[model samples]
Target chain A: MTRTLLGVVIAAFVVLRVWIWRRRRATGHERVRARWGPFAGDVGLVAGREMRERFRGKVFRVGTLLILAVVAAAIVIPTLNSGKAQPQQVGVVGALSAPLRAIVVASATSAGATVHFVPEPDRAAADRDLRSGRLDLAIVDGRELIVDKPPGPTGTSATAQFVRAVSNDLGVAEAVQAAHLSAAQASALAAARALPLQSLQAATTKGAVHTTSLIGLVLVFVMLSQYNTWILIGVMEEKSSRVIEVLLAAVRPIRLLTGKVVGIGLVAFAQATLIVAFSVALAQGVGSDLLHGTAPVLLASTFAWLVLGYAFYCWVYAAAGSLVERQDQVQSLAFPLSLPIVFGYIMALTAAGSGSASELFKVLAYLPPTAPFAMPVLVGFGTVTWWEFLASAAISIVCTVGMARLATGIYRRAILRTGRRVHLREVFSRAAG
Target chain B: MASLLELVGLRRRFGAITALDDLSFSVPGGQVVGFLGPNGAGKTTTMRAVFGLTDLNAGKVSWNGAAVGPAERRRFGYMPEERGLYPGMLVGEQLEYLGRLHRMSGTDAQIASKMWLERLGVGDRARSKVEALSHGNQQRVQLAAALVHGPELLVLDEPLAGLDPAGIDTIGGVLVEQARSGCCVLFSSHQLDQVEDLCESVTIIDHGRLVVSGRVDDLATTGPRRLVVRVEGDRDASWAGGIAGLMISEVNGGEARLVLDGDVDSDLVLRVAMGAGRVTKFVFERRRLSEVFREALG
Candidate 1:
């Protein structure tokens, strides 16, 4: 399953590249027309500078390596610990009936375990073997089950489950043998089936899907926080360094701001793609069940939300960055801006982990700010339809356009106002007046 | 015809304070004009308005005879009062980037960037990060960024504020050459003497209002003439006091500097000086630019 996912990701990248190339070719005439147009080559130049700076920065390189290392460990460690379960050793004292032995073996199979039996000379020997941990469980004279520790009430552990299964199956077989008047009756009792179950509502997502959703939510949260902060700091750096004044002289504030956000967004997208691709490939290579049986739609939803979430939050961060001229000011502003993101991430996490999307969670899926995290989980749970996802996306895109305009306005008004922090109220009031 | 840049009725307000009030001036092509003012005299604001960096309350910036727009502004280069450049970027790359932003093609930008860096005497440091250069070197790079695109109107704010004498001479020479090449160069500086040396004309503003502007020689000569006399071993200015409409502005050892009205006879003042003692020196001269600047502001 992971291998297929890896292949799909690689193919998607190739398809995206080809589509971009074709789109460029299609837009060639338009680009030519725009070459002599106003603000031509502005955004590309800005984005290129940003990409170069980020790629050159040591922090980006080191941070990506660290995250990859952690991701690899998360994938590999589980597989190593849970590789192949050790066989359960069971001791039997006195004469063991053939039917009883068969029942014990069958019980172990039902518990997803294997058993090896050892004959004990007496009860004391069986007790000694159980005490010494040589035997996981023992049967005393075909009557009682003995173990080093008492089994859990629900038999949650592997050993406890195996012991419980063995005891119950053996007891049932003995009772059947005693009650049976004919062979057909005993066989019929042994083959009894459970009644069919039904539910009125739709079934929730399976455990694998739930796990995938949780991972997607985490990726969204981490990526949003990381990239939004980059935009914030990048703006602050330009402002504090006073390089913005030079840039604004050559380019319009709107064009400059647009270029900056687009540049940083590109870097963020590229970094995210690399991380996702690395994770899928690592999981596939390591034979880990992480992301196993993950639905393609769920992966797409996660990536889509990532883009949408970035689109929604980047402008806010960029605008906030323009208001301040100091690193300390950036810190003070960043926390308040991140409040909504943190809230949405936590709420989405709860819904994904619990495998249940509440009404509020569903409502959050429609809001642009929270939709990036919420809508994808709804997709994972199969609670949100395709149209619903599109509606939420459309809403987010609309909100993002509005946000970009507002942010551009604020950035334009405040970026050149150096020395002191510019207030949002000041910008808005001036615009209104 | 060489292009002319004009700022007409430019007005701007920062809350209650007016930064530029009906400020109007013209920078003719093939000339270097000094934008002179004290601190907070709207020089920077006016320059920013030229590039549309500052929102004007009212103004029209025109080139030649048409109102300047993005296309015209693209042909203009500016060095802000507060020097700004990406500290982490290579000097040559930074210049190239600015050149490209100003509409130069990639190859043209590269060539111009190299030429400007070499001309600014920072050619060896082109590959170095801007932050690694000395302050003067960085300032040169900043100037190079503005000039790299061969702008028709080069506006610099305090371009010579912190330069050493050699740096000043280099930049001053560049400005003169740019003007000779038919570019209109407008720059603001607090160095009055340097302004006098470099600018062909000047526009002086105070409290966001234009005080005086004209050809440097015209403005200086239009001010009241001074009559300077040196006596043989006499330190008193009583010789010049006998002449009507003559006021002694200064009296040093054996020398008296007098301000004369238009009707005052400079020949008679010299005669009076000769009668008082053996005259060593006599001359009539217009006020210096510094004197003109101070008297205009006062």
Candidate 2:
């Protein structure tokens, strides 16, 4: 995962820079407006700076890519070795001829079991796997079966059912032999009975893993939150240091703050893109079958949501950062701001795990801070229509604009009024006043 | 022609602390005005109030006959005591960016930044990160950033702070050059001698109230007229009791300190001192601004 993040860092610098150059050259006011966007160039610059700085950070960049790599491994490893671990993998002891072995497979099926003659190599691995809770049960001598001792009620009953079936089979066969049944009759009975118990159940397919882009989205949101917070803190640091007073004389606060946020956001986008591209290329190159079925939507949503989520959260953090002039105050303040993010993330995770969006999760999708994470999860779940995605995007964009206004107001109101952590009350009231 | 910047009845409150209480002052163009005070004297607070960084509880700041809003303030430049420049950004980029913020376009910003960097003798360090610059050089970068837009008014709070003699000369020369170019420069400094050299006018505030303000020489000289006389020939002569127009106050080291009548000239006092003894030096004491400040606050 950490290795995968390397690509994002490289891609962010190259691709985002290209994007910026393209933005600069874009034509008319309307044309420029369309391509460069109203705030994207500025926002991109900030995000880009942040992405570069953070992706270069040993902890965040590496941790996220590591997580993605782990996810890829989970999706791939199981599917690649598909046909090996099933209940049909039967364990047997004692010397039996090849034809008798076929008969035992028939008999086990007759008793409602499909047997795979693992022949020792698998039995050794199965023994280890059983201890690790992998296999359902191990059959020895086609009679003495070993099952994992599951806690509480379920384990004993299942064991009893297996034992009773094997014993009943032996007893019925013995009774039939005493009544003078021929070998041909027993063979006919076993084969006909084996027909009644076919056991090949398909597990959850990898196709479903592609649909789980929420994890990817959460990654983007978390990164956006962290990067945006960095921007906020950066602004506050300047203001508290009394630098803003001088800066105000040179440029408007709105422009300065906007430029910073855009710069950092662009950097972040680059880092994320590089990591995504790196992982994809690496996965493809390695023939890592785990990534073979991983959906592009998951990666795409992650990148898109990262940019969108940052647009929404950066202003809030920057605004929040402006409220306090001192570094010590940042930690206490960062917590309250992060609460919505945490709540949104938790709700999104719950929805992802259920493979469905609940009504409550839908509410989270509309919230600006949460939407970047939650809405993407909804899209991944096939739970949202295109209109709904568009609606969420629009709402998020609106929320971002509103947040920028609110934050800028809060920042401008409180940044110069330093000395202690100015109460949230003071910030609110001053803004209102 | 009248003044570049004016603050009328500026008042600010931080909870119970009235940082500035109805403060008012003006700085005309083509001169440097000294903003003087000790710690807690609202020097910085007043500077902030003028820039419109702090909300005016009840007051106004006007620049060139128009109210100083955020846009209006963009035409002015300030160097706050906080000493801030983006640490991670390149020196050239930061300067150009600030210039742009002041409404300078790309060509103008680039030109100003390049010229200023060259003037500072730091043109080679343009691509260097601000963090990599020396403390004095960083301060130079900050000054450059402030002036890159050629603002009409420059408010520099503690402009001479944290500098060695060489740094001071460079800044002082720059400030004088700007003032000579008809820019109004209002700066606060603890170095009274520096202020004496640089500022034509001085405003001294204490405890959120204006104590004294006027042309520096006028304010210092406009108080009571007092003279110091050194007499070589006589120590016991009645230098104190009998000289007309000489309100002598203290006598020591064969010299008499006296206050002169308003219409009195130096010759009258010189004649009296001469009658007492052969007068070598007769100097009038212009009460140092520092002494005036002490008298106001202490």
How large is the interface RMSD of each prediction?
A: 7.4, 7.7
Writing each residue's lDDT as its tens digit, candidate 2 over A1-433 gives: 5354555556655875786586457432223122212323333433334444454457665766675676566545544544222444444544435654554454555444555555434456657756775554565544345555533433333333343454455556556666787889877765554345554842222244433464475566557666867786787778765667666655556766787787677656655665566556655554554243335655665567777788888888887887787677888788888888888888877777666676778988877778877877776655678788778889888888888898888777777766777666887774321
Model 1, span A1-433: residue lDDT tens: 5566577778866975775465447421122222112335888777777766776688878877887786677667766655547888989888778878888988999887888989999889889889999999988778788899989778667788888898789888878877764788887887888988798866767655775676678778888998899989888888888888888888887778777878778877777777777777876687766665645578778999999999999999999999998888988998999999999999998888777889999999999999998999888887777899999999999999999998998998888888988888987765321
- Residue by residue across B71-154, what tens digits does model 1's lDDT show? 888899999988999989888778878888887886677778778888989888877899999999999999998999999999
Best by DockQ: 1
lDDT of each: 0.84, 0.70
lDDT value, residue A272 of candidate 2: 66
Residue-level lDDT tens digits of model 2 in B1-298: 6456878898887777888898988889999889988899999878877676677788888887778887777778889888887777667767766775576765577778878887876777877888899988888888898789998888898878888798889889999999989999999989988888888888889878898888878877875687888888666547646756666666787777777778877886788777876788789898566655665566
